[model samples]
Target chain A: MTKYSPPLAERIARGIGHLMFLLGGTWGVFIALPVSVAIAADPIQLAIWGVFMGSGVVAAFAAWRGLYLIEYATIPAMAAGTLIYVAAITNVVATGENPGSGLALFLMIALFSYLTARWFSLNQLLDGPLKLLFKRRQGLDE
Target chain B: MSIGTVITLIAAVLGSSTLAAIITAFVNSKRNKSQSETEARAQYTVEFNAIVAQQNIQIERLEKRVNQLEKAEDYIDVLIAGITNGTIPPIPPRI
Candidate 1:
């Protein structure tokens, strides 16, 4: 009989990655607002903040989906989402709303999402148990 | 908070978030490098196993061919020995 092995590193990496994404979302919503409010942007700027915050929510959802599905989906989705976000922020900047704030928020979200996604993907790739799971799923001998 | 206060607050928030993100990216990248190395090692082990299996098959096939050739040589030697000893000479009158 063949022995079975598990991918421990990969699993731990994925769990940590998802947890980061979840926390990133939490920071965007609750922490960001109060921080922005304390500094005092105009109504239009506040609206921009809301938009940035909305994008963060979308990113978090996509990352969560990756965690459950492909283990690598988070990276691509987050990257694409960040590109879209940068574009959105660029438009807002052109409109003469406190562009710096929007750009800063965009950068932060992009960095967080990218890091989280990468962590998960790499973790899964290195996991011994995960490899066995994949082989088993394909009906190959372990 | 006054409008100016709010604007300042937003700036501060954005700045802090950016700092946090940069720090996170740095940490994550470090971890990612190690993970990628591990994955490569695992992949290499599988490939090594496959190569070994193929080599085993080839060796087995070559050994079989050698065995067959040895048997043919033995038979030829026996025929030659019989002929030299005159025990199995070429007979012309039997026909």
Candidate 2:
């Protein structure tokens, strides 16, 4: 019997998904929450940070269980984080302050978002169109 | 550069790179599948040729055996005629 091996893209995507889970967990629990508390952020700001924290917990759980939910949970958080970082950068620039840190954070979030999106897209393709195409081709060959 | 310009540039770079990565992955996956299929077909062809070769060898052996059997039968027919016409002596009875 032939050994079942996943495609290269799928292997890459799974690696990215696991990385996202780790990054999301770190960002939510260690970075976002502590920073919000240290800054004595307002309720609205705290809630925004809470989203990251929640996403991180979900990502960790999904990763632990080896579920696809990691991709779903992290992508939205990364997207929201990217937007928040952009806004923070603009605010810093308006105050005549160096926006370097904000920009760096923004870059990180943007990169994570891109990776999560790629993972999601690749998984979708593998399960849907690619599988369908392979099935149809097999049928035709038969 | 202004903050807006920098942000725009970053967005454009990220967007284009993401699109390119996905498209490349899709194309590469298709190429990988086709390559595997070609390899499997080549392997199967090699196996089939080996089987055919083995069968041919067996058939040649069978054909040789059949020729030997036919020649033996012809010799037996000639001996039977000689014995019946008394041109060749038959085996003596054992005591």
Candidate 3:
């Protein structure tokens, strides 16, 4: 039999990560679809929702992996999301139609999410620092 | 006395005892503080001596370097004198 050896804390973190992944997946599907459908008349609005939902999935995956590995993982997905939203905005601007406020909000959210990920990475709060704090003493190791 | 009165009296006694204990502890600590300070002073002296020794080593090293530089300066002065007297070829300082 394979040895099942993970610290209690790590096991808990992974469990929580899986739970968050499931919840975020469900939430993303439910929340994005109806709203995008409602905004389907406007191609720009639809594009914004599509990008938001796609990046939302990536962000959710990043969060899950961050917890699973107990490290701040790469969050370039949000940056890509910003780029896509900006492209959508550019399209609207090129067409001389106002892209409206919704796309702007999604763009802001993408930037904010990237900043949040960066803050987490810099602080290393959840795992790196806390793990160091509670590490078992080397002297006591068998 | 009622149970409430008795409890109140007990609490008051316990509080006063605790306060007295704290005061006694503080007084004892104050008395022994000189001894603690003396130990600390001894530790400080040891550390100060170590730092002074390291400083002395550094001073000796710097003094040796200064002595070497002085010797070099003297040699250069003699060389300049020899050049002035045509005993040695003049070397340009620019190079």
Largest DockQ belongs to which candidate?
1
lDDT of 3 by residue, B11-56 (tens): 3443343344334334334442222322434545676899999999
DockQ of predicted model 1: 0.06
Please provide, for model 2 over A1-142, each residue's C-alpha lDDT reduced to its tens digit, 9 standing for 90 to 100: 1222334455455555545644754565466643323233345554554454345455444434433323333545544445444544555645556545565656756765675665565344233345657878999999
Candidate 3 whole-model C-alpha lDDT, 0 to 1: 0.43
Candidate 2 lDDT for residue B63: 100
Candidate 1 chain B weakest lDDT stretch, 10 residues? B31-40
Judge the docking of candidate 2 as incorrect, acceptable, medium or high. Answer: incorrect
DockQ of the two-chain complex in candidate 3: 0.01
Candidate 1 lDDT by residue in tens digits, B1-95: 44444344544555454444444444444443333333444765777899999999999999999998997777777778879998974543311
lDDT of 3 at A67: 29
* Model 3 chain B: ten consecutive residues of lowest lDDT: B31-40
Compose the digit string of candidate 3's lDDT tens values, residues A41-127: 244434433443344443444343332121222233233333433444444444455546456656556654754565344233222
Please tell me which model should have the higher lDDT, number 2 or number 3: 2
Off by over 4 Å in 3: A1-74, A99-142, B1-78, B85-95
**Residues A1-142 of candidate 1: C-alpha lDDT, one tens digit per residue:** 0011225454455455445544554465467644434244455554444444444343344333332223332343334323333444544455566567675666757675665566454444443434546767889653
Q: Cα miss at A99, model 3 (Å)?
A: 6.4
